[model samples]
Target: MLKFVKHNLETIAGVEIYPIISLSIFFTAFVLFTVWAMTYSKETLNTVSNLPLNDDESLTEKHNF
Candidate 1:
């Protein structure tokens, strides 16, 4: 089955560029996210980190299901 798919793909023109384009997009997004995370403010990070543990009534009311 794998061999059949590989043979079909090998017969197509311009098929090889798809993998290169996908890899480039993934690499670019990963780099951007890493940079953003590294530069994120510590104060904002602390507030976000504590959100789950916070017992504020307003949050629970606003998000009530």
Candidate 2:
């Protein structure tokens, strides 16, 4: 089954570039996210990290409208 798929893809004109393009896209996104995460504020991180443990009332109070 794998051999059959590989043979079909090999017959295509631009099939080889697909993997390279996909890998580059994934790599770029990973790098951008890493940089963003590294520079993100500690206070915001704390708030987000504790979100699941926070009560609904607390959330409303903290972000009062």
Instruction: Quote the positional error of residue 24 for candidate 1 in Å.
Output: 0.3
lDDT of 1 by residue, 1-65 (tens): 99999999999999999999999999999999999999999977776677789988775565452
The top-ranked prediction according to TM-score is 1
| TM-scores, each model vs. reference | 0.81, 0.78
List model 2 lDDT by residue over 9-65, tens digit each: 989997889899999999999999999999999987887777778776776577552
Candidates in order have lDDT scores of: 0.87, 0.86
Report clash pairs, candidate 1. Answer: none
Q: Pick the candidate with the highest lDDT.
A: 1
RMSD in Å for candidate 1, one decimal? 3.6
